[model samples]
Target: MIFDYLIYVFLGIGLFFNVLAGVGLLRFPDVYTRLHAGTKCTTFGSIFLIGSVILIGLKLWWEKDTNGSVLALHSALALVAILLTNPVGAHAIARAAHRSGVKPVRAIADHLAESPPLQTGEKTDKKQQPQEEGGK
Candidate 1:
């Protein structure tokens, strides 16, 4: 009975975070903020949801059920995958978005632009180039 209640609580928390992520994605003004909300919220939500499954699996395994062991193992593996991939994927997307010229809203300082690494054959916009003293 207690285990069931715990499972319900975990599920509820997970659902709440997931819903919050959706809301953030929809309500945020810029891509960076949206990505922040979406990625962090979803990752946190998935943790709770998967945790509930792990608990269920443990309970079953304690009862000497083989399926319970399998379920627990698989759930753990899934959690690991999510933990490893979510932030990295979000980072990649954010970097790509920045590289493609999407600027954050109301940003005061752009660190990436200030110290960009050298890349051979990179084209600079005409406006970025220095004009000759005599207007060559």
Candidate 2:
């Protein structure tokens, strides 16, 4: 049936993107780049894969199957969950990595360094200032 062919095509496309994500994870030089590739590719692949499931569910439901309705609903919920969480999780991971002192390759300016979070006023010695006007 045409629907079956459609499912196969979706699955194939999903598989391709998923594989690309894996390759990107391995090939990218830095954490941010890897996170970008991994998150975007996996999210896109999951959309197609879940879409195929939804289509199958709809087909079955059209044939008056109760289980198909459940499958479709659950697949839709899962897709929503993936859409919401994937990017957020990736962003959290990248932020954590940066905070932990991992610098991006060839990055010139770190904006986070310019504006720090509000701090309670506590006097601390400025370490980076020159101790003497000339070399002691």
Residues 1-136, candidate 2: write the lDDT tens digits.
Answer: 8889999999999999999999999999999999988999999999999999999999999999999999999999999999999989998898789857788999988766422322222124344323321353
Off by over 4 Å in 1: 114-121, 125-136
Scored by lDDT, the top model is: 1
Q: Which ranges of candidate 2 are over 4 A from the true structure?
A: 112-136
- Alpha-carbon RMSD of each model: 7.9, 9.1
Candidate 2, RMSD to the unseen true structure: 9.1
Model 2, poorest ten-residue lDDT window? 114-123
Residue pairs whose backbone atoms clash in candidate 1: none
**What lDDT does candidate 1 reach at residue 113?**
68
Q: Estimate each model's TM-score.
A: 0.83, 0.80
